[model samples]
Target: MHKTKKNKKYTGKIYRYTMLVFVISFLILNSFVHWQMQLQKQTKEAKATYTAETMVQRIETYLNQYQTKSVLLKQIVESDENMNMVKFETLADFIIKGNRALRGIELAKDGIVSEVYPVESNAQAIGLDILTYPARKDYAALAKKSGEYVMAGPLELIQGGTGMLLINPVYTVGAASEKSFWGFTILVLDWDTVIEELNLDGLDDSFYHYRIWNMDIRTGKQNLLIEYGDDGLKDELLVSCDMRNDTWYVEIEPVNGWFSTTEFLVNSMICILLSLFFAVLFLQYAIHRQEEFAHHEEMMRAAKEIQEANEVKSRFLFNMSHDLRTPINAVIGFTELLERHSDDEKKVTDYVKKIQLSSNILLSIINHVLEMSRIENGKESLNEDTESVKELIRTIDAVFETTSRQKNITCEYHVDVIHEYAVFDMTKVEEIFLNIMSNAVKYTPEGGHITADVTEVCEKDHKALYRITIQDTGIGMSEEFIPHLFEPFARERTSTESKVLGTGLGMPIVKALVELMGGTVNVESKVGCGTKISVELFFEIADGKRAEESDQKQEISSTEGIENLAGRRILLAEDNPLNAEITVTLLEESGLSVDHAEDGKMCIEMLHQKEAGYYAAILMDIQMPQMDGYQAARAIRKADDAYASIPIIAMTANAFEEDRKLALESGMNDYIAKPIRMEIVLDVLKQWI
Candidate 1:
């Protein structure tokens, strides 16, 4: 009876313990499954964020490249003396081929579609007036009015396809804020091509949904530009892009609403083993956290670098504004005063001199900055011509003589050359000497001494090496700063140098110019002692035959020998009314007969109407309507008329070496840059007419 009672109590205890273990296991499994689901959700969100961000970056990069191409086209058009329709068409075709999204490019002159690329395909768009068209007028007006790039819809097109159009307005800036709208450059992008390039259709399988909304300035509403996947997703990641004059928003989310099939399977397999599930889950969570921290750190570093670059750019702009405005303000103020006091002879002379001084300073600043930019962009090249070495030195001395006298500084120049002439770019050589000498004069204290020395180093095989040294007695620089002297915008930051007015571009430009000319420059200085700079250059010695030709040419270039200019008939082709009037007045005052042609077409018509050799020469402005100077020159060259061989002198504002070469290539006998000097015009006339 006692043994039976003991066995029954033991069995009851076992049953209770078994029931408690089973209940605990069930509760633990439920918790594990819930935790796994949460892990899966977090992984999916992370993946979606990464994928969406990557796509956004890619899209932005693509758009930026296209934008760059558009901007380049605008620059080309603005810089061209005459816009050649054929050349523009070629450029457009190249762009379209390079970028699959671009369907066509169109150019408008004052709202009229004057040119379009892929003529066979886009012939219908060639004559369409952008301002008069109902579908395009709004965007065209917006772009012109805002003077900024305007992006318009994936709207239905006249060519039976949908496309997005980006319109950019080109304007010619007049004095002050007065802007004359030049025209419009249009970039037409196929909507389907854009979608494909952006891979919007493939984003669904990539586990993300995307929606793009562009704020329409016209409607004052946000219109959907593109959308992919379901809009009903609960969680979505959003990114905003600031386009010029418009705002665009891009929203993205996971297709499965934060649920991931891969993560679910991974977690489920681990959960089946129960014991290993917790350990593996914890390990994975730690690893993921570590990766996230690393990614955050990398992002922070990149952001910091970008911020630093932006800060540098801001500082550069500040410096440029201050430097550029100083001389410009002086020029403007002095000019206004001179104009008002024109009646007083003595005051007029003094004011005019002051204005000229200020103008020279402003031009110096502009030239330095532009030269540096050209050098950095690898566009700078030497245009060599036979020049007298002594003549060049004399010109330099004349330039600085007055400045030195005003400052009471002793300025001396010396040259020792075996040959009187050399094949060199005289303009570049003058710049090299003037920049260095100017620096010396600027840095030297009042009554200090500045000296320039040029000597022939060696001569071999018709090439001569020349050494130039410029020394200044002024507050000098430390040895440590000498190494960085050739860097752009690098200046001594000492109190003694703080008040000095400089563009900080002189030394760098000098260095680049010297290097470009196959030369070397060196500097020696001790703080408070003085500074000395030496440059060695190689120049080809001009042969006797070329030298004689140059001398004969120079003789003909003189205005003194010209006695029959009054009998010469000249045709001036100019578009701007103001420019035409000024040019005509100047020419007539020089005792020459002047006839004006409003455009290249008119100029050609006038030439064709007149008898052969009736006009002595044609002074052509490069930019004109109906036709441009280049095309006119070509047409005249091809004409059978005797006047076709008459001198065509290109008077243009495009004043670059490349411009001169192009002018020559286009059959122009001579080229003169505008802001036209009467003296130069007379000289050109004396030579050609």
Candidate 2:
């Protein structure tokens, strides 16, 4: 009996241990499964949000292209109030051919369709009155009343289809110079074509169901523009974007719900098997934790990067505001002073000089900002041309001559280049040198010494590497700040506190332009002693023919004196009356007669009516009403008259190098950037005429 009782006790112990093990395993498996499900849910949410954002971006981008095209049409119509069928058809054809999403472009006069491009297919749309149509009238009236582009549709077209319409109102100047509504420029985009271009249908078929929709402004009801995949989208993610006057929403959801059933089942089976061995289950759990930690680290890194970008942008804006306001304030204050002391000639002269200095500062800031933007956008490029190395060094020295002399600073330039002429982007090279030398002059105190050394370091494969080192005895930078010196909008605290006038974009632009040319820039500085900057750039060696050609061109560009401008009559095409008056006054004061035309069209007409050789040259402004300078230049070049080849110089505020290139390509003899200096004007005229 005692033996039997002992055996029963052993059996009871075994049963209890087995039950405890099973219970613990079940609990562990359940917890792991729960964790996995939650992870899957989070992943789906992130993916849905990302997909919705992507869809919105794609839709907005596609629609914005068409909207921009419509605005161009509006500009054309407003410029030429008498726009005929041929011109309209030509412009429309160009736009449509460039963009495949466009179904047709139409023009409406007094709310009636008067013209349509691709006339054979959209012939029925002609003569249709959009004002009388119930489906289109509201948006058309909205566009006319608001004087902004209005988006409408997925409505049936007169040509028997469905499409979206972008309507832009056209306004023209009446005889009294008052604005009057001309009509509308309408752009039609087929829905299916846009969808295909944006890959919306592919997204629906691949993994997620989506809906693109908007709220009807008139009805205050949900209007579905596009729907794809399943009927029901549970727990959908929605994102909204604004286009012109409308708000568009993109909603997305996984087709198989948030969590995949097959993945869940597979995970559960793996977890159950792991539970049989506690150590294996623990290892899996640890690995999962490690993966989660890694993911969190990645997310934190991304967040940090985004935060840094925002901070940089904020700093740039702050510096821009301060820099821009300084010169503007000076200009305004000096102008007021001049007006108050109008009768005092000395005070007026002083104030005018100050205003001119401030204007120069303002222009410098604007140019730096534009240059930085071009660098950031990867739009800056090298326009390699044959340039004299010696001339380049001399130019930098000449540019800083006055400033350095006024400061009592000694400037020295050393050149050891073997090749007299080499192919390089002369403009960018000049910009780099000027920027460096300007800073040196601005920072250096009186009696400071500055030296520039240029040497041809090596030559191989028809390329010569040139090294330029500029050293200055100035208020140098701290070693810590040297690392950030090439960053955009980076400024030293000492410079800012001293009220130094700069946009803080010079060094950054220099660095970008250098790197763009496959060059290197380095800086070394001491706290109170001095600073040194070194740059190395490669240039292609120019052959004898190129060097000879460049020398000939340079020789032709030189002129005798301003006296040569006497007795010359030139046509000035400027839209702004104030600018025209200023230019005319300046030219007349220099012994030249100036005839002013209000716009490009008038300029062309005046040229045509005048006898050949009556005008010495033409000064054309780029942005004008009726027609732009490019159009005018081309028309003059194509004219059947002796004066058609007359010298035309573009004088405008489109001051980039590309603008100058375009002006020359448009049949202009030369270009002069505005906020014009009289010396430059005289030099250009001498070269061309």
Best by TM-score: 1
RMSD of each: 36.9, 34.0
- Please give, for residues 444-537, the per-residue lDDT of candidate 1 as tens digits: 8888998888899999887999988999998888999999998777788743645666656667777888888889999999987889999999
The per-model lDDT (C-alpha) reads: 0.76, 0.81
Clashing pairs in 2: none
Off by over 4 Å in 2: 1-369, 496-501, 558-571, 575-619, 622-651, 656-689
Please give the distance, in angstroms, between residue 90's alpha carbon in candidate 2 and its true position after superposition.
99
N/CA/C clash count, model 2: 0
Residue 102, model 1, lDDT:
87
lDDT of 2 at 107: 93
Clashing pairs in 1: none
How would you encode candidate 2's per-residue C-alpha lDDT over 371-405 as one tens digit per residue? 77677788866678898999888656544555676
After superposition, the stretches of candidate 1 with alpha carbons farther than 4 Å from their true spots are: 1-379, 494-497, 542-554, 559-568, 575-592, 599-613, 624-649, 656-671, 675-689
